[model samples]
Target: MLAYLADVFSALSELNHSLQGRELNIVTASEKLAAFKEKLVLWIKRVKRGNLVNFPCLEETVTENSTLPPTFVAKIVEHMQMLCTSFDGYFSCGELQTCNIWILNPFMQNLEDVDDDGSIKEDLIDMRHNCGIQMEFTNSQLDHFLASQREAYPALATKGLEVLVPFATTYLCEQGFSCLLHIKTKSRNRLNSEHDMRVALSTKTLRFDAIMEKKQQ
Candidate 1:
């Protein structure tokens, strides 16, 4: 079961890499992940029925009980789906086709113990009102707006920035560590490549425009 999950995640590494460091709305990722899990269950059934089980007990477990619940899939999905969002509110944070507002409502409601400066509270109200009316809440717009008002709303701006902070998906981190291990293999260590060691390792592809420019040069 663990090995099957590894296969599923390996297939998803490219998607995880593509999304790293980008402001995300995980509604679609969650749907695709659920679909993939269903596909995996079907594959498992096919393999087991065909005598492809790696262990004898796996054959007994899968072949005997054709109607057995996919306990492994359920366990994995329980934790993974927790990290996903079902768009509980009216905002996409600039990640949707139809731009909507209310992205900051839930996050604001969650903040506690804020210092009571009348100015900061006023700024928060104004920012929320103004941004909520906009067609979208893009990361660049958020950055510029916050930068211009940092001194005016230090605490609010900090918290607002935190709300927009991006996180790497689990598969991306696993693939990165895998790459690091491969790059620093004992055979390569013998070559004393300090310059190479200084480069940050990543699995993401470069932007298409940047790659084209490099090729021209």
Candidate 2:
């Protein structure tokens, strides 16, 4: 039973790890969540049919024992059903159509399909033809690319920013806690960690070579 659950949780753990990290946004989170739910549905069907390919450890144990008890197999199916119900209740597709299309590729989106006034559509048309900015959009991060467009394409960029900014706050809180642990040691028990904590939590990249060149030996 424990081995069977380990297989189930191993799949979930991989999904959880993929959704975490500093750079994660709703776009990536939504895609992963949708894929995981689909896998759960497929697993439920496979397990019901006695297909243990998805659960290697469970299969190995059953092979050694000649067969798994009927009661425990039923329990596993029930557990998977409960998980699918819980996930469906918690997550829903809430991002707007324009936001999704813009993130994928602004140039490719049809102006008619965009859910906006004429102004945003006009901005999109202009952006599609601007080869210079198009190159930058392809090269840069979604949030950064949208940010750079704010001056030239306020409406379009603002909509994208609304979707791209505000990534997982839970991730930020956990990151801050990890940084605190690294900075606060037994030897430095008396030290004030406010300044060091800021540096550790900051998203800015530090240039060690430039700092060393400026420092007096």
Candidate 3:
């Protein structure tokens, strides 16, 4: 479903040639999103009827027991609304013109302005207004700016860049879950200890020769 939506977003071009390389603007996105969601809702119902897909982790294979019910489908449909609400502010922050202004909302409400320590500094705040607008208004652009100007901005570069990068999916999370499954299969139900499990699951290899040379030294 995610891959399908991604393709649709990539293919759907604005009539104006000026937006040829850019992502879909809000108004265009709304129309496309509504159409996509309508089709998606119907497709989801069909999948439920077809009984092809499986729950991510569970061992259950029975269609009658595993397939999502109608109420659950309706709940899933509300996710589009939730997504739109979430993106409304973040999208505003995507533009250089509005990005800093939206970020510095005094209530600490804008996601980019939010600091966990509640000790956001004046220098960092000044950097936002001073530098954020001059840069290109894209996640990749900001990432490149930090990569190039680490000495110039220091910690503020990291702080500002962190919030701009969006989380599209749990790709790493799903990979880690699959790794856990591979490590703890039916054959090996449990490890002796958490430390043992960590050692077993780690991708690193032993450097016995290096350790021996250090010991000799």
Please give the RMSD to the true structure for each candidate, in Å: 11.5, 2.5, 14.3
lDDT of 1 by residue, 120-215 (tens): 455555665675433334434554555555686676566555545444245446656666676778877676444443344534654768878889
Q: 188, model 2: CA deviation in Å?
A: 3.4
Question: Residue 167's C-alpha lDDT in candidate 1?
Answer: 46
lDDT-based ranking? 2, 1, 3
Please say which candidate is ahead in TM-score: 1 or 3.
1
How does candidate 2 fare on TM-score?
A: 0.87
> Which of candidates 1 and 2 reaches a greater lDDT?
2
TM per candidate comes to 0.35, 0.87, 0.30
Worst 10 residues of 2 by lDDT: 93-102
Worst 10 residues of 3 by lDDT: 13-22
Question: What are the runs in model 1 whose C-alpha is more than 4 Å off?
Answer: 1-120, 128-149, 166-172, 190-217
Clashing pairs in 2: none
Give me the overall lDDT of model 2: 0.81
- Give the local distance difference test score of model 1: 0.48
lDDT of 2 by residue, 131-193 (tens): 998899889888889899899988788888888787643778888888888888898888899
Of the candidates numbered 1 and 3, which has the greater lDDT value? 1
Q: After superposition, how far is residue 184 of candidate 2 from its true place, in Å?
A: 2.1
**What is residue 68's positional error in candidate 1, in angstroms?**
13
| Candidate order (TM-score) | 2, 1, 3
